[model samples]
Target chain A: GQQVMQIPQYQHVQEGEDFTTYCNSSTTLSNIQWYKQRPGGHPVFLIQLVKSGEVKKQKRLTFQFGEAKKNSSLHITATQTTDVGTYFCAGFDAGNNRKLIWGLGTSLAVNP
Target chain B: SQTIHQWPATLVQPVGSPLSLECTVEGTSNPNLYWYRQAAGRGLQLLFYSVGIGQISSEVPQNLSASRPQDRQFILSSKKLLLSDSGFYLCAWSTESYNEQFFGPGTRLTVL
Candidate 1:
């Protein structure tokens, strides 16, 4: 079975600080997707990376996919109170297209 | 424009009670549907997915079962609920297996 491991199960950072969460897969991935779930809300799709060693950015948030396609990271700069939420990364195995292997996710808490 | 709908934003059920949650997608044809559960302060756990009507794949074996009677309709049911069944259940739809998913608002289940 394919598995995705995420680091820093929980993080608490003050406003204006930076935060990063990493995701690693046990096998090669066809693609990786990132999502954010605000408090009391459902998960919302943020971004997806397909090319190896690709990087994408959305305002203060940066996402990078490893050259091996087995690891990914999300970094947020100058966190705000609105940035408080749980971030999840899901990966699709190159050999398995039926389902996406999901990480346990990283919970981010920002203090104002 | 696409939308996903989930009924009963919140539910409270006693142990041993039967459970049913429904999800539907609008403005999309033959979309891939998925059911996921997330315990408090935990990560997402995939329960089931459907590629089309009557086509379902279970990710984890539990007391839960899923059905897709219609192309865009997915249902999660349990014969008898347990205390561990309590969680945030989310329904998502994707255009393809490797595409980003659109999630419903989700249903909060509290088993007593």
Candidate 2:
């Protein structure tokens, strides 16, 4: 079975600090997707990386896929109170019944 | 435009009671639908997914079962719920298996 491991299960940072979460897969992945869930809300899709060694950014958030396609990371700069949420990374393995392997996720807490 | 709908934003059930949750997608045809569960302060756990009507693939083996009677309708049911069944259930739809998913607001179930 394919598995995705995420690091820093929980993180607490000041309002102006930066935060990063990493995701690693046991096997090669066809693509990786990132999502965010607020305190009491459902997960929302943020972005997807399909190419190897790819990087994408949304304002203060940056996402990168490893060259081997086995790992990925999401970094947020100058966190805000609104950035408090759980961030999840899901990896799509074409060889694994076409299902996405989800990570345990990293919960981010920002202090104002 | 596309939208996903889930009924009963919140629910409370006793142990051994039967459970059913409904999810539907609008403005999409033959989209890939998925059911996920998240315990408090935990990550997303995929329960089931459907590629089309009557086609379902379950990820986790538990007291839960899923059915797709229509192309855009997905249902999660349990004959008898347990205390462990208490969690937030989310429904999501994607244009393809590897594409980004759009999630519904989700249903919170508390099993007593």
List, residue by residue over A19-109, the lDDT tens digit for candidate 2. 9999999999999999999999989999999999999999999999999999999999999999999999999985763688899999999
Best by TM-score: 1
Provide DockQ values for all models, in the order shown. 0.87, 0.79
lDDT of 1 at B43: 90
Worst 10 residues of 2 chain B by lDDT: B52-61
Interface CA RMSD, all predictions: 0.7, 1.2
Q: For residues A1-112, what per-residue lDDT tens digits would candidate 1 score against the true structure? A: 7899999999999999999999999999999999999999999999999999999999999999999999999999999999999999999999987788889989999989
The number of the candidate with the highest lDDT is 1
Please provide, for model 1 over B1-112, each residue's C-alpha lDDT reduced to its tens digit, 9 standing for 90 to 100. Answer: 9999998899999999999999999998999999999999889998999899999999888999999998889999999999999999999999999999999999999999
Candidate 2: the clashing residue pairs are none
Docking verdict class for candidate 1: high
